[model samples]
Each structure stands twice: as structure tokens, then as C-alpha cells.
Target: MKMTTHQPEHYNNLQKLCRICGERRNKGRPYHSQTFETQIKEVFGVDISDDRTDVHPKYLCFNCQSQISEPSNKVKEIIPVEWKGHDDDDDCLVCDIKAVVRPESFAVPEKPAPKRRKSEIKITVVKKEAAMKLKELNEHIVCSICSGYIVDATTVTECLHSFCKSCLVKHLQTRQTCPQCKILIHETAPMQYIGTDTKLQDVINKLVPGLMESEIKRRNDFYANRGLSVPLNGNSSRPITPNTQDSEPAKFPPDDGRTWFHTNDLKMSLCIEPVKKELSIPQMPMKFIRCSMKLKVEHLTKYIKQKTLISDEIELTCNKKTLANDVTLENVWLETWKRKEAPMTLFYNKKK
Candidate 1:
């Protein structure tokens, strides 16, 4: 007979097993003809045609295909299976397809958290607008006398001008007018017209941070430069206790009632010369009186103004020389009145 031997069943039915899950099925079954490259392209939306010639056609069942296709939740679960013949290949078709398709599904090891410190320094940034406002406000607090930030600030009541206390004291030693406004602060005693403006000082302290401490240092430096002790209360009028052991005792007693003289270390007995009718002083000559040698010529001028009710538009002279307001009694005594007597004579003339 023509039909003799039956072909082998193995040759008749070509059965294939899944390379990934090892699922076996006959040729006509659902996934028997499925390939790793085709399945990757269909399921994972990955095209592996360029690398398909280099890779053998790997078979996969429906379940294994779905596992790799929808690996969003199973990325960590799916261990990369190595190819049987390729020892160097750690990645399987499922993992390769997943990496090509949804790379974000892989679990990247989380970075370790940064170490925290116990103390964290915080920086404060001031805005340009706020800084500008502070700068603008600072101009008002500056002293007109020294053109510096006011320290131990004093104000002229007549013109309402502010200055540092030392600056104003030094200014008034020569001038009776305000440094800023040129207004007459006092005809005779400008120092008496000025008072401590604590309100302004407090305002400055609030406006300028660290200003009070710096001002204290400046005042201390001033005292140090003059070889004088810094006053505890910062009042110039406050008497500094002298070192009695180092200083010689005063020849005369302290003039406790006198407000003009600072100390009575040296004394001079003055004789008032008889004034002419045209002169702006007393018509009759006055008696001799002891005075502090530290007194300025201006102090004598003020005294004459009080006693004789003469106008300030008058000048004092000794030996035909007009006495400067800054001239001290000791200097005048040494220069002009030394050879006269224990009681020296002084003359006054009207200012032309």
C-alpha cells in the first residue's frame, strides 16, 4: 500500500514551551507561536525588530506575557531571569521590554535623608525699601555742630537746634548764637539756654541700633584723650572727685556758691578802675574782690553786665589791650596784671 509507515507524532505536531514561564502547548494552541520580540511589541508597545536578528525567538504564554506587559506594580516583583545559554545576560525579555516601555516603573533606591544639625543659623535679610527708610530717618538725628550722630545731645531752646553736648559747650565758649540757625540762644550764657534733650536721645537710640554703645565708647575716648575720668552719670557739670593724695591742696576754700568758676585752685584779687561817663560800666569804682584764676574774661564780662546793668556791646581792656573772651584769669594775671599789686586793676570801654 502507498500509505505505509505513519509519520512520527512529534514531527506532525510542533509543540513549544514559554521561555519565560516554561508553559508548554501544541502548535495550534493560543500562545504556542508567540515570540518575545512580537509579544513585547504587541503588549509593552516596544519595537525590538532591530535587535530581533541577534536574539533567538523566545516563546511566552498569555499569563507570562500579561505579567511583563502590565509590570507597573510587578516591576519590583519580577526578578530578571538570565538566558540559559548566556551567562552574562542578567536581564530577561520581560525586564528588557519593561525598561524599553515604562522605565519609571523600576524601583530606584531611595536616597538617604540628610543629617540635621542641632543649631541652624538663620540669616535676616532687610528689604531695600526698609533699609532706605532707615537711612532717610537717620539724617534727622545727626548733630549740626559736629556733623556726626548726636551723642549726649543737647538742644537750643531759642532756635530748636540740636547738637552734641561737648560740641555745643565748645561752640558757646566763643559764640552766643545757635550754630545752625544763628539765632541768639543767649546774650550772655548760651550754656544755660541749652538743656539735655533726653527725648531726642531716646529716639536716636531706638532708630539706630547699637548706637548707644558706640556713643558711650566715643565719650569714653573723649575723656581718655583729655586725661580726664569719664563721668558715671555723663553729666559735664557733675564734679569729678580729685585725687587728693596726688594733687596739691587748694590755697583758697572752694567757692561753693559761685556758679561761674569750676574750681578755686588759684585765686586773684581784682581792683575795678573808675569808669568815665561815656564808658558802659559803673560810674564809681568797685571794691577789691577775690576771683577764681580759672575764670575766663567772658565770665568777668557777664559779672560786669549783672552789676552795672551795662549792655554786652562793651569791651574790657587792660594795658591798652582788648581782653579776649577766651583769656583765662591766670594768663591775664601773668601777662598784664602781675606787677600791679595783689589786687589788679581792669578797665572797660564801649565797643565802637
Candidate 2:
């Protein structure tokens, strides 16, 4: 006996069929007994039974619905079977398929690369205090004449007290006593007593910065104020030139031009005598020239050597006594030849 399969009224007029397998249940076969919508709703939790509205319904065949309900082997690999115990039905079969295809979502979200902490650093400083006080410095480097810090420092031989070179020179131009102790430095030529204290100068340079340059500037300013030419060294005192307008009355009347001359400008006769006959004269033995009070005995020996063509091996004597070269001609005249108006004779003796 042949039996006819009963088809639903909805399947007879359906234009759409199962979305997964594209199959319809219109054929008179027993395998097409169930509607595709019912199978899809049971497996994937989607209802496609109603067809009254404009929205199209999606359907899945019984075979495709059965395959979707079971988790895929790929999905099982990423999510363990034990995870089913905690399964929530809200996640649909479409969501399970996405998780199977893209497995990165299930991986333990790479525990956000351990937060790096910066190391704390500390710095230490050590401060040192000055060892000496400002007031205590005065006892060591104070100058007597300026009563300040000594610059271009000089020391007196007679009395051991220090002063600035310029200050001492200016003071000694009029006075012959030490500025600090008032002790006699020299009876005459007070400048001869002052000497440069190199040790003290070095100490001052170390103690005070920029002192030497400032001293040179001050000496330059002193000469600039006086309208005089500054010395090249800037250490020595300026030479004093005699002013004829400020001179005292002449010792003799104006008619005597020879007597009207200053004592320093007076002409004196120098007679050079050679002890040995072998030495020839460079010029005349007797020379009459203007004499300066500042001319020393050494200058006369030099002049005699030039005139008499004698070498430095010759020694000179005045009044049978060996003349000290440092003694000035004016000093020798006052001591020995003040009464003699004739040419002052210098006898030369050859050194053996």
C-alpha cells in the first residue's frame, strides 16, 4: 500500500525555504516532515514562524540546526568541555561560531604587560665653611704710609716696616725717616734705604686678587695727573727736574755768566793720568766739561777709560785713597776738594 505525506498549509504557499541548506519541505517525502523554522528556533533560539510583516524570516534545515547546537571541535580546543557547567543560554550559536573562527577573544587577555616602576634616586651635597675671618687679615698685610693693604710692597732696611713702593717713594722725597717707627732710614738719599720686598709682594698677590694690575694703573694715573711721561717700569719715582724760574738769587752778579750757572751745571776739568806708559790715549788726557752733581765716581772712571783708551783693568784713586764708585762727584768735592779751584785730578793705576 502507498501512503501520501501530508504537507502543512504554510509550506504549500512558501516562497523561501531553509537558509542553511536551501531545501523545501514541499516534496511528498517523509524526510521533509518538520518545518525548518521550528528546528532553527529550537537549536539557535531564533523564531522565524511568523510571516505577516515586511521583515523576512531566516530558516535553517534540521541537519544544519543539529550541527550548530553541538560545539565545534575547534571551539572545544579553545574552551574546555567543563566550561559547559557554567554555560549561559544567552550566547547564540552564531556567537559560538564567531568564537571558534576567531580564537583570540578566549585567550587570557595577556595580563597587561607588568607595569614598570621608576627607581627613586637621591643626591647628597657637602658644604664647607671658610677658615679665616676678614678682620684678622689686617695684622699681616697692612701698609704704614697708606694705612691700607700693601701693594708694590717695599721694606726699609733701617726699620723693618712695610709700605707700598709708591707711597714710600713719595714720602721719602721729603723725609728720611721710616713712616711707621720714625727711625732714621738714611742721613741722605732716603731712597737708598728702600728695597723691593719680593717675598711680601708674593704674599700680597696671593692674599689679594688683581692687586698688581691696580697698582700699575694707580702709578699711571699719578703721572697722567701731573702731565709727566710715565715710566716704562711704573715702579720707580719720577725724576725731579730743577726749575730755573724758581731758582734762588745768583751767588754772583749777572755780568759773570760763568758764576750765574747752577752748581750742578758748573764746568769741571777732569785730568786722566795713566800709570803705565804702554797704554795709548784715545783722546786728550785733560778734558774740561760740564759736571752734574748727580754724576757718581764710577762715571768719572768710565769717562777716563773712554778718553785714555784704557781697559777696565785700570783702577782710579783720588787724594791717594781708592775712590768708591758709588760716591757722587758733588760729595767728593765737598769732602776733599771744596777748596781746590783747579781741575780735580784722578790718578789711574793699572791692576797687577
Candidate 3:
């Protein structure tokens, strides 16, 4: 009989067929025919049906009955996920979601014994003395760049390696890679990736008492004698303008005597810099220009094309990541390039 949704569950569950196979008898009474198994054994005085026959039927094992049987084996719906706009008529969608199963665990489980009683833990408090030797973390206390005790500790964001702030910054001006791991700090200005490790510095200072104070005093004396503003995290506290340069001015070549154009409008101005040893065809007529923050990458491409008589497409990049033509320069400056320093630097190359 075909089952329907409206069928009474009790009526559907009841079966009065063969005890062995739960099927109807097909042959003559217990002797000449059978519905499923047809084996028969005759005892001393009487005839006996073999196992699985109508007379001597064997029930299914527990596992087989649970798996092969119907409703009793169905997983109960303990958690119903509401599909706001789902249209698919599949009933098994609930099983696909991760960590959403609520399987009934009927098997007995062995529990782990607690190491300490909750009452004992809550009531007890012990005084413990802890001491750490400097030699244990000797390398951690020393600056990887200087190979000395860390002074004004700073950490590289990419590799999470700590070093002397001055050593890391000065190293970055020449090379933009981590000294310890050689990971790229940044494509443009690697100095920005360096962060002051205040906690690490504090730990170092405590480990070697008076080191931080002595360093700060020595730094103050040196700067005072030189008649310069005190330094801030290895950099000059005085804000650098276009006309002036950092302490190490002789290292970088001059920007062709280019200076920031004085303007009332607070729009962003950038230095269209070609990388070192790059072709001079890319060198624009004006190295500096005051433009609206809303300038798109396509505008920059067109501008570059006008300056250089070339048919090849130009590609703009910040931190070595290509810029989409539609993205505004301000978005790139704020989100991608992240060159907060005045005269934001952007690198470009011909799309090969």
C-alpha cells in the first residue's frame, strides 16, 4: 500500500505479517511454499521451519533496525533555522550548515575527573615567588639590528620583530625590508610600518634598571648641544616642510628644486616619483601640483600620457599594489597608499 502524509502513524506502524521477515505468506500452510526464506527442517516427531522461515523468524539486529527502519531513526528537529526568503524545497538544507547539528547522544560517555575541587580552589590562595633570568630571553632583549641592548624599542608590523627604533628607521631609509626576517615593510615608505613597542621597552627597562632614563638623558643632552628640537620616537619633533629635509638630507637627491606650491585650498599635493634608475621619459614637466582630492586614477593616466608622448598604457601603484582606474586618489591615499607625510609619494610604471 502507498503511504500518504495523512495516514495514521499508529496504523502505519502496526504489521501483522510473518514474524521472521514481516511479509505475507505466499505458499500452502507452512509446508510446500514460503514468502521469503524457503528452508525447512524436520525434527524427530514434528516438522520445524528453518530460521527466517514463517514459523521461525529472526528479527533484525539493533543497528540494522535503527538504520533501515523508518520514523524511529529520523533525527529530531531540535533547532529550526528560519529561512527568510529561501525558495528551494529541499528538506536536508539544515544538515549542510556547519556546527548546526544537534545529534541525540544516547551512548554512555566517560567524563574526566576534575583536578581540583571547586570549593578548594575558591577558598585557597597561595603566595608564589617568580623570578626570570635575563639570560633566558637574552636574544629578545637585544636589538636584532644593532646586536646590543634594545634602546627605544620598535617593532616591524609585517614580521613582528623588535629592534632599536633609530636603527630600524635608519635601516629602512636605505632598505625597506626587515633586518631580522627580510620581509617587506612597505613598498613606498617602510618607516610607517615601524611601531613603538612601549610594553616591550618597559619590560626591557625594568630588566635593566635606569637604561631608559640614561638613554633619554643622553638623547636630550645631544640634541640640546646641537640646538635642535628634542626627537620624537627616533624622528625630529619639528614638522618637516617642503623647503626643509630630515636630519639626513645629503642621502636623497634633490627633487629638481621643486617646492610645495603655496595655496589656500587644502587639497592634497603629491610628488609623482619615478623609482630610482627609472627612465626620464616618465619625469613629468612639473614634479609637484596641487589637485583636488577627487582626482581618479584615469585622470592621472591621462595626465601622465600628455606629459610623455607614449602609446603604452600607464599603471599607478601605491605600496606596489595596482590602482583601479575608477578609484579616486584620495581613497587610495587614505585607504591604500597611506602616505600621510606631506607630498604623498606615488610610484608608476608603464603597463607591460
Candidate 4:
């Protein structure tokens, strides 16, 4: 015998209820498997399966089914970074280093501190004070040659001699030697007159001690030189030109004592110069004088050659530093004899 199929009267009703809950229908998608966690998603919202397995087996959508299971352990928990408050006094948990917990009594930082100014320093500077004392302690000395007080600071003469303007002028007029070193005072013009002032004091303070000693020695040597030894009264008068013979006159021929010379004599006899054989002088070839410029050039060239052939005549003491002013002219003449001769062409070239 064949058996007949049986249909439950509530089948359609159960299907309609499943559609409302968004569960998968047997005719459509399959149901979620029996996993430890699951999510059931519905058009309305998600449904969750509790940790308890005793709950009834229920149809669920994929989204709602996933929500039902215990929340995914894969997702990480996010906590915000929390800054500790000043009052909280909580230690940092991450870094091992300790941060100072400033106290409430501490004052807030204001503007940065100002730098110290050296000029404003109130400390007593011994060196500067000593310098000041030195300046005051120094006494002004009179120049022996000029009889003038040495007041000018920059006006120290070559011999370490110093003097007032009028006195120096008189000294130069009368003497050429230094009042200090006895070395020849070559300079008529003093170094430069500068009375002691702030600027001058600074300069003096900066000068080395040894240089001052040298300066003094130079001046002493100058005053001791022979030229400065002329009598004071004699110095008052005009300086005397140097003479070869103090009292004698130059020699020349007397008028009437010479032997007779005929009128035909090529040389004439005068009272000053008696008849003598005519000297044969070198005569240049007879050439027409051209431009005056050319003649001058030739003369200048010869002069330069003579000058170059001679050397300086002035002599100084071995250790002496300066040339004496009065003796300088004589010294020049002395050196002229040894000077290396220069070509006349040099002078002519210089003119061009």
C-alpha cells in the first residue's frame, strides 16, 4: 500500500514570522552554523546570541547572528592618551625617566635676565688707578738746550729731548746736537706737540717701559754731543759758518812784483792772478748749440754722474741712533767722496 504526504496547518504562518525577523529561509540562504560565537543581522537591527548555550535554537540573519556571539577578540580596545594635571601628581607610566613635579609655590618664568655690562662694573681697577697715579707722579722737566719746559706729549725730539715751541726754535738756531743722546738731532721739526690729555695719557700708558728708557738715553747723548757744548753767550749770536782757517785769509798773487810779460803773451797778468802758462783745458768739438733744453739736459747728466760716484759723508757713532743736526751738512760732504757714480742719462730720463 502507498502512504499519503501530510502538511502541517502552521507552516505558512511560521514562514511569515521568520521573514519578519530577517532570518534566512530554507528556500533562500542557509542558516548560520554552530560556532562558539555568531552574529545575526536583520533589516531592523542586530540580534545577539548570549554566552549561555541553553538558549533556544533560533533563526537569525548573518549580521544579527554575528552580533549575538561574544564580540570579536581580534578588534583592539582604544583608550585615549591622558595628560596628567599639575595637581594630580601622577607619575608617567611609559618612560622610566622621572619628571620633576614643580611645586605650586614656584614662581612663573618671566623675561630672560639681562647681561652684565663691563663698563658699568663698580670694582676698583688697580692697574688703571696705578696708571693715573703714574701720570700725576711724573714731573715735567725743562729742555736743557732750549731752556723750555718739556710739556708737549707727542713732541719728543730725536734725542729724547722735549721743549716748548720758542725754546726749541732757539735751540735749533744755536745747536744741532740732541740734548739727551748727544746724537745729532737731524729733525728740525719735533715729533708732534701734544700736551697731556686723555688721549695722550692713554698712549703713554700703552708705551713699553724699555722704550721710555731708550728715549731718555737718546736725549742725554744728544745734549752731551760736542756741537751742543758751544758757549751759551756765543749761541745767542748768529751761527758762524765753518771755516778752514780761523784767522788767515786766502792767498792770491800781488800786483807789481811779477816778472814782465810781453803784450803778445796769450795769458794776461792781473793783480790778483799773475802771468802763468795758460792751462790747456778740454774743449768739446765745435758743434752748433741746439735747443737750450738739450744743453741743460747734458749739464744735469754730468752732475748726476758725479753725485752718484760719491757716498754719504756723514759719520755717526757706532751705537748712535740718530744723526746730529748741526754736523749733518759736514757729514754729507764727507760721504760724497765714496758715492757710486750715477749715469747722467738717469737725470735726463727723470726730467721727461
lDDT, model 2, position 328: 76
Model 4, span 183-277: residue lDDT tens: 66554322122123334434443542444445444543443443332222222112223552212211121133654332211111111110122
Candidate 1 has what TM-score? Answer: 0.32
Off by over 4 Å in 2: 1-130, 188-192, 221-230, 234-296, 304-352
Least well predicted 10-residue stretch by lDDT in candidate 4: 265-274
Candidate 3 positional error at 138, Å? 1.8
For model 4, state the Cα shift of residue 84 in Å.
Answer: 24
Steric overlap count per candidate: 0, 0, 1, 54
TM-score of each candidate? 0.32, 0.34, 0.33, 0.19
What are the per-residue Cα lDDT tens digits for candidate 1 across 33-132? Answer: 2455665655445454543312323445556566666756553343322222112433333224343223443334499988767576566898775335
Show where candidate 1 strays beyond 4 Å.
1-132, 222-228, 233-352
In candidate 3, what residue range of length 10 has the lowest lDDT sum?
39-48
Angstrom error at residue 90, model 3? 99
Backbone clashes counted, model 4:
54
Q: Return the candidate ranking by TM-score, descending.
A: 2, 3, 1, 4
Indicate whether candidate 1 or candidate 4 has the larger TM-score.
Answer: 1
Candidate with more favorable, higher lDDT: 1 or 2: 1
Q: What is the C-alpha lDDT of each candidate?
A: 0.58, 0.54, 0.56, 0.31
Q: Write the per-residue lDDT of candidate 2 for residues 282-312, one digit (tens) a residue.
A: 4445545546656787887777777766674
Candidate 3's error at 78, in angstroms?
89
lDDT value, residue 162 of candidate 4 = 45
Candidate topping TM-score: 2
